[model samples]
Target: MLNQIPLEHILLLSAVLFSLGILAVITKRHAVVVLMGIELIFNAANLNLVAFSRHDPQLMQGQLFSLFVIIIAAAEAAVALAIVLRVYQHFNTANLNQIVTSED
Candidate 1:
């Protein structure tokens, strides 16, 4: 029943998700929020890849590549979060506006 929706609709939704991710990444000041935005963007990309894979029965590699992307993203998030925590510890603030300081 759900398959009635056109491929255009799925693409539109993915575009919206990607836009929201970009907005969040640009507008948010917290590192965690930025990371969340990045994850959202990654998810949007994964959705597109999966949709394409499903559309093309002969090409199943997209889904496999998306799976790899997810794994890599998870590792990236972990490392980024650790760095954020260390920055917060040293600066006593998580706000991006307040985190940047002299390079001395």
Candidate 2:
């Protein structure tokens, strides 16, 4: 079923998602929302990797790389969430702008 659809369309969708992720990361001030934007960007890359790998069945390089990316992203999210929790405990706010003003 996927073979019928052109690769260009898949790539175009990934590109659009990547653009929106960038916008969210840039415009949003909340820490968790920014983290979600980062996840979106990672997912966009994962989509491209799977799309490209679909043509080559012998070597699943793209799929393997995408799996590694997913693992790393999970670990990153866990550590970042821990840090955000600590920051919130100290500053009493999760907003990025407020985090910058805290002296100690």
Candidate 3:
């Protein structure tokens, strides 16, 4: 069933996701939203990895690498969130612009 879907379609979806994630990271002010965008980028990469790995069932390198990415992403999210929480507690705001302005 999975093989029925064309690779172009999957690639296109991943591209769209990656683009949106980049836009979010660039434009969004809230720390959490920025984290979400980063997660979206990670997911887009994972989708591409899985999509490509589907072609070669024997090697499964892409899938393994994607799994590693997932693990790293989880750890990164936890640490990032902790830092964000600490910043929020100290600054009373999650907005990057506000934080910068207050710092200045």
- TM-score of every model versus the real structure: 0.90, 0.92, 0.94
- Provide the overall lDDT of each model, using Cα atoms, as 2-decimal numbers: 0.90, 0.93, 0.96
- The residue pairs found clashing in candidate 2 are none
lDDT of 3 by residue, 8-70 (tens): 999999999999999999999999999999999999999999999988889889999999999
What's model 3's lDDT at 57?
Answer: 86
lDDT (Cα, tens digit) per residue for candidate 1, span 26-92? 9999999999999999999998998888878888898999999999999999999999999988888
**Please, what are the lDDT tens digits per residue for candidate 2 over residues 1-104?**
44466899999999998998999999999999999999999999999999999889898999999999999999999999999899889899999998898787
Lowest summed lDDT across 10 adjacent residues in model 2 is found at 1-10
Clashing residue pairs in candidate 1, if any? none
Task: List residue ranges in candidate 3 displaced over 4 A.
Answer: 1-3
The clash number for model 3 is 0
